[model samples]
Target: MYKKILVAFDGSPYSQKALTAGIELARCCGSELHVLTVVSLPEYAGTVGEVEEMVGKAQDFYRKKLEKASQQAKTRGVELKIHLLFGHIGETIIRFAQEQECDLIIAGTRGWSPLQRLLMGSVSTYIVRHAPCAVLIEKGKEEDGNG
Candidate 1:
């Protein structure tokens, strides 16, 4: 029933699995696929030049990863749109999904421990609670060798 699908990708093994799932769903539903990678800004402290350099490197890395994802989607006969964003991950993802009018959001979770999740906050959880559309969280699976 989905018309547009957005997947949060970060080049992590978990996110790669999410991409695969998103691709399959898009292929079956004939939905448009959008892959988003967000690069968090460096912590405040370093010189402006250093901060810029770090951000630049992160952007480059995400670009390459997105390119690879694009190629994979193309091979599967699915057109993919890639988005690079900088900001708080959860907020940015929710905003982007809304802006794109996506019907569903597919995201991968690292399966952090309860304590760790409590301390660091869970992006998947936040998205599930706040996203404008439906959210599917692909928990990291041990058998998939991605957990």
Candidate 2:
């Protein structure tokens, strides 16, 4: 019963898997699909010009990734709205999901070890805990086959 679905995509293999799942779910439910890619800018330790150049390159990279995601959704007969966000990945995703009034949020996990997750803080974990809507995390291919 999802009317609006948001997928967090970063062009990684896991994210691509998440996109596929989101697209199929939207197709079956006839829901509006939205894809979001976030660019987490590193703390600037260089000159202003260097910071600007870094941001520019990141934007260009994300643009291409978003374009590819758009094409993939189109091929599946699903129209997708793309969003480019800058900020903390988890917070931005949760905020966008709320702002868009999304009914569901789909994301993919990198399957990190427990220690790594604890130290690095998983974005998927944060979104799962904080998202206003239902969160669907697509498991990695290895995990899917194993379990």
RMSD per candidate (Å) reads 1.9, 2.8
Instruction: Choose the strongest candidate by lDDT.
Output: 1
Per-residue lDDT of candidate 1, residues 1-147 (tens digit): 999999999888879888999999999999999999987776674688977886789888888889999999999999999999888899999999988899999999888899999999988899999999999999975446252
Backbone clashes, each candidate: 0, 0
lDDT of each: 0.89, 0.87
- Candidate 2 residues lying further than 4 Å off, grouped into runs, are 44-47, 141-147
Model 2, C-alpha of 130: deviation from truth (Å): 0.5
lDDT for 104 in candidate 2 is: 98
TM-score, every prediction: 0.91, 0.90
Pairs of colliding residues, candidate 1: none
What tens-digit string does per-residue lDDT give for candidate 2 at 1-147? 999999998878788889999999999999999999887866654677866776798789889889988988899899999988877789999999988899999999888898999999988999999999899998785445222
